[model samples]
Target: MDSKKSIHLLYAQYLANKISKDDLALLLDQLASMSTEELALLTAKFHSSEQISDLKNTEFNSQKTLAFIQDKIVVEEPRKRNKFTAWNTIIALAASISIFLLFKVIYQKDSSLFRATQDSSLSSISNQAYLSLILPSGETLHYSKDLQLLSNNSLALPTKDVKLNVLEKGQLAFEFSLEFIEKFKNKTYLIATGSQASCTIRLMDGTLVNMNGKSSIQLPTIFSKEFRTIALHGEAFFDVSHHKTWPFKISAKETEITVLGTSFNVKAYQSDSHVLTSLSSGSVALDNGTHQVKLTPGMEGYATKSKGEFNTRKISIQEIGMWRSGFFTFHEEPIIDIIQKLAQWYDIDDIQVVNDHRETFSGSLSKDKSLTQILKQLEKVSNSKFEITERRILIMR
Candidate 1:
């Protein structure tokens, strides 16, 4: 057999947990000697094969295999030879497997493992620690003070000797200090939260906004007499003050939401495939130029960028602002999607899903919990296992 076919056979045996020690050594030797182009072709073949589909159900301990490969595979340095080593071969194999698993999970269809049911018992997870103020001039100001100060409804600014107060009902009243009023007036400001931070701000019109982690809201220092408009780039809960004549408008990617007065949640993250607007009270209209839909209390409207059309669904009113109270509520959400949310909240830098069964999850989790705690609960409810190393998280079945 050709070297390519031989390598494929060995890899298949390895996956089946049927490879002998001598065969494993021979496979590593062949992989280390192969060129980059040849390795790429092998990876492509692995990706297209049906063997990968059976990975999720395999009983082999991949963690132990990886550990053994790392510890046992060592190629002695040669005086005048190619640079490839056993370590390089192991890394390449590991990367190829990871890529295959991720692609399979993301694109797999007609698989029962993808189906998920709701679990009412699960709670939520936690967030990062910094908030920032970006001025229109491009200067970014970091809030370096203790976030706990906000709990007392007043934050003392050590840099400016001013008190930034959180008004009743969790509204961050920036207008309380004359210094802030003078500085922010007439200029546009972008309030941003870090990967593990959430913020609440009171707009000039008394509209309360609770911003989720890794989110931002851009607004002028003052609203125009005819309209109150803001642009959102992430998720937020809005409680708009009543204004019959002046309409509150929000531009979230392709969707534009118009409201006279209402309390609702807008999840418009650029990374998300859809812009979701869920209402808790009053009424709001969602338009994306191509289509328009009006939402009443307990209704949720969503639009995708690719389709540019609006769709509506019914949700519990209590689920509207669950994020504000440090909880995440999901309904038949994909596992990858849930991990993306957890990555944002925990400031995780890298994510890898291996041997994914394409499972979906539904439930609630408290944001106050640790990453380990959240993943433990998730493991109990699903067939996946989670591993964390530094800032990276790995999901496997």
Candidate 2:
């Protein structure tokens, strides 16, 4: 059952004076997960119900409601210390009282909402745009995508003389020099893409890395004698140079992808629990020492650190690195996972899913369109409804 639906049911039962202590505890936990905007929406939605207005006769303990919500936030997920803000706690408490009071009205007037599912809609919304480049000197440059790179040597960045050559979108070319090559032999630099941005980088080794939005890669100034290793925090499509002796290796959390010279896409964000690697051509080995799997063209490899399991299955060739190519491939994927992708690409925070979404959905969306345009397409497939605010997105059912 959806957590939000469970909360409504529990709220109804509580108003009827029949809720158990366990149900109340669960309700508090669910409420804590909701963002402040969502809580406000919940209160405002039922505030207008005629049935609720007549529920003034019902009595409730305000102090106990506040206490329960506060206690839950403190102790519920001790490991998630960064999950809550001071303002969110205040919103939760305010929501708790409003929820406790409004249920009497909702139960009496709008009981049908308990059985309601989700609907999605889209309106005009805007996303902030900027990309981050961390130099070897620890200085950061937050530049817009339209800004061109003026320097001929891509590796000679973070310098005042660095120039911009506004190349066409999705174009990546790296011109190297023996002097510049020697300069970056052992040094490392970082590149990060924003919500509305994508970048193609040519490495010192002639390898091309096409980074998707909200993705990052850390590359060395020079490849080691034995291996060409890079660390990835998000998603990227790699076109590696063929080196029989110096194989390309990518580290994403607990998983490592190794290939001699191949084209592959890796989606392994640090925030995500599972790391996904899809090979378009050439053979690649996904290894974490304890478990290893080899992927062929049109093959997808999935590994979860928690389970410590590596699994492989065949997918379509088109699905590999579709985002960079301009589309999203969602197959048996959760709505939350999809939203996380949007959050990263859009540079959005405060995404709230009111209900538990155990259902999986499959489809494709174009990346060329705006956020609202893509969301309207999403509404046709999912049971959840979308409410886009100034920057936050609220999902309800």
* lDDT comparing candidate 2 with the true structure: 0.65
Output the worst ten-in-a-row residue range by lDDT, candidate 2: 116-125
Residue range 1-397, candidate 2, lDDT tens digits: 9866876776665545555445656666665566555554665654665545554323233334556665765665454444346335444544565555455334334322211100000010112334555544444445656644322224545343332233465554334345654665555556666676788877768788888877777765466787887778778999999999899988776677899999999987656778899999999998764678899999998875653779899888987888876777788888888887777677576688898977788877777778888787777777888889987988887
Output the worst ten-in-a-row residue range by lDDT, candidate 1. 116-125
Please provide, for model 1 over 1-397, each residue's C-alpha lDDT reduced to its tens digit, 9 standing for 90 to 100.
8876799898776655555546766775676565556655665665655645545322222233444454454443233334455445544555544444333343333221211100110001112336665443444445533544222112333345233466786556554245654665555556667776777888878888988887777776567777887878778999999999999988776677999999999997656788899999999998775688999999998875554677788999988878787887787887878988888677787889788567777888999899999999999999889999999989898
lDDT by candidate, in order shown: 0.67, 0.65
Off by over 4 Å in 2: 1-131, 149-170, 173-185
Clashes of 1: 10
lDDT of 1 at 340: 80
Error of 2 at 246 (Å): 1.1
Q: Which stretches of candidate 1 lie over 4 Å from their true place?
A: 1-129, 144-163, 176-186
